[model samples]
Target: MRPICLPERVAARAFPPLAPIAFACSLALQLSPARAQNALSVEPDTTAGSVPLRVLDARVRLGGERVRLPGRENMGLAGLTELLNVGGEWWVGPGVYGAATGHRGGLFVPGVEGAWSHPFNDWLAVDTGVFAGGGGGAAAPVGGGLMLRPHVDLVFRFPGFYTGPTFSKVWFTSGQINSNQFGWMLNVDSSFRYRPADFHGTATDGSATGLGFDHVDATVTMARPRNSTSTAGTPMTQRIGLVGLRAERSVDGPFWAGIEAAGAGSGGVAGYAEVLGTAGLRFPVVGDRLSLGVRGAVGLGGGGAIDTGGGLLVKASAGMTLRLTDTLGIGAELGLVDAPDGHYKAETAAVSLNWALDVPQRDLSDWFNTRPGTPTRMEFGTGVERYRAARKDGRTEALEAVVLQVNRFVAPDVYLTGQAHSAFAGGAGAYSVGLFGIGAQMPVSQRVRLGAEALAGAAGGGGVDTQGGAVLQARAYADVALTDSLSLRVAAGKIKSVHGGLDAPVVDAALVFSFGVDHKH
Candidate 1:
């Protein structure tokens, strides 16, 4: 059965009250002097005379709210962001929000956000923020899925964290969801050291200090549904195929923590997804070459007709990892997944290829230490794209997306990129794409360059027939320098499913930020 599309009348109801709220908050942030002086401060000795890129703030927020999903029901969203201080009392960065309530599990939104914060005294402060993004899933009634959320919080400050009560409003520009709710929030403070974009040198000391993660893994998973029941109490029989990404950092001797997010790419369950927090302990069996581990995770998951009441799930696994190199490993796991409040049970097996990063951990009070002469050049950006005449469920329509990307220069005129696209228009709110590949460029002038790229990734959902979710895309782009560290880019591209009937012409525009970091080899 096909899902219902949103009503056309919701498009005209875009909220107008946000402009004043945004303006007032901006004014308050600009006039405040409370959080300006030591915004990016680190220890004086190791960071002296160094002009490195800095992570001004890293925060994780968990919140809950109730919405009108045909009836009043609870929803939870978790947020993470790495912000850079722009000026006095203001910070801006990229952030992602995902459903953690399990009731409507497949919700994911990737967006850009800004915040204003000021201290009232030594122990109390106010923080306000606004997020703009696009996404939808689980047949939710978010038309076009362009979502906006604005929030205000009053927090009690501690040494390295804050606890607060928050009030927020969530609205969709072309959808039938307008919700206001109050929730509790917790925020942690953190920082990391990095290098400048123009850095091209060799490190003398054996140390690294950029991108605080220690490891990343790409996973392919297969699950056998056991005793699973549909939302309507019907019997279900389907095997699920999922692709996922995991990132983690060590906390103590053998303990580590991380985040994992995955989506179903096959098995007729396109809109099923989960975002979870994981912790584990690893013990070496063969002196850094082989290891065994046990991991446990809990989070929200639903959608795809699997009944996960409130969307909460827990999983446990045992695995072994074999080190192929100093920086790479392969692993396999056997696990049990269960939804306590819903009728879902599964036994899963997964294989993963992982890469190791050596960035050391730094606390909120300390700065990252990078060895001099490390060479890392990169660009990060966010923008929008439009797909003309995309094929979905035997029909064709235009779709719009919010895109986030990172480019790492391997040579002066050559680079590699990773990108994500989330659909927000044309009744395709649940559709998304992830891609990685290579590109080349040359300078036409001091301010302009042209380039082309080819990429392949997995995409599904929104009833788009991606047939196992493999896709390829190629694009040509023009970039114009706006400043030494910023540029404006526009591109035209073609995207096609490898085994399905989704072929579309895509056009995009974005603003890119360039940074460089020095690290040890």
Candidate 2:
């Protein structure tokens, strides 16, 4: 904490009736002359200025009402809310608030909140920030999930403690035909603050102040994942490997927030690029050699690793760093990350090299952010199929089919499809059908891919007596990539052969060979 005494404000603001806590703060700041200004006796020493920029705190946030989900049972505010937070805050630039852990919604209101703060004096400050991210199913509401929080507080400098009231409201960008839900609580916190220059001994000039410099970081990650909503009969993806990069600076005092980019599930079934916003606080742990901190983050991207094909996600983690030299340090963390579709709940471990660009040495505010890789791709293939046809004329026959198809990805996990197929039997003439429509896909791991598609097109051949008609089809399949240019798939689907006068139901199994086309942004 800085030892400088602050000058008192000119007047006291009236306390509002809704918050008794704010009323107490107003009274204290108004009546306590000894503490209203110059509340501490510590002196500022230029020789002792190398203190690491930091902010650490723990609090229990009350999420107080019940939120109604579409089909699942309603959950109380406590259930929809985060339970507690054991993390640090970055007060640098715009400010960052985060906490990574076993589950996401249990702290810091379920995701990273970027807010700004202003200190009135040595004894008071206020903060405001917002949170918006997506992952999970409709159980979390539609694609746009959002939260906002505003805070007010009083500080006690001597023993390093603070207390205040915080309020919040959360809702979906959509859904919630009922109403929005709000939560509030009393935040009692203890924090340790520091900055990079604080470790540089008295280098009070240049980049150490982070005034005109850039902050950069690089790291490698490994995580063990559990299958995302896959059943006992489906293929599964169980792990991921990632390499990442970050660039950010403090907007507030010790709070750092920014975007991070990474490539996970490479050289396997999990191949895609992702980007997310991450934030956290860095505080002093062992003078100049060690540092400990907590981090919170959320992001969106596409890859099989993201079970919903491509969607929003949340992650929570804590880590430590050992400074090896002025601009070089190594760190690692353990945390959990989950996807929106409930496809993956990965337990992760990562190691990184933390550095500052300038020669004087500075601590770069760490916030996690991300950018998505090419989540869109194309597939075209041909396969052999078999089906039993029950004709309207009361004739039933077994047939052989030659099926050709093309699929195009339009979103992270959705696709548009078109296909043509021909069937032949000993006494029966050739039967053909063409189809067009949309579908969805999911990656179970690096090698397995699963999806389903629907299409409608023109039908002709002897089955239609040369008078072509319309045909509709729906199919689901599982794929195993055999090589960079090859993949094999197994599928089953229902075909409505209305044009062929064999309209009841036709089912077929196909052995397909697939190759990809470019994924242009």
Prediction-by-prediction clash tally = 13, 55
Please write out the lDDT profile of model 2 over residues 1-521, one tens digit for every residue. Answer: 66542211101111111123222322222222222123333542322234323222322221133344456434333211111122234331111122111121211122333344455677776655454322222123322222333333332222333334334444534334233443333333322122321032333312112111134566667777665433222445545566566545443444555556554323232223344556677777688679887776665433322443224467788999887765567889999877653466678899987754333211122111112121123455655555565543567656554555655444446765555454423222224444567888798997788988876544432222212244467778887777643577877877664334544344454433332211111
- The positional error of residue 456 in candidate 2, measured at the CA in angstroms, is 40
Model 1, residue 24: distance off in Å is: 34
Highest TM-score: which candidate? 1
lDDT on C-alpha atoms for all candidate structures: 0.68, 0.43
The candidate maximizing lDDT is: 1
Q: How far off is model 2, as Cα RMSD?
A: 22.2
lDDT of 1 by residue, 1-521 (tens): 66543321211121111112222222222221113224434542233234433444444444444444546655565555556667788978787666655366667777888889899998899999998888877667788888898999887898856766777888877887788866655555544345556544444232223444457787888888899887778866888888777767565578776767676667766557776767788999999889999998776566666776666678899999998866568999999998887788999999998765443212112123322334446688899999864455578888888999877564566776777788878777777776777888888998898989998777776777676677789999999999877899999999998778889898999998877544333
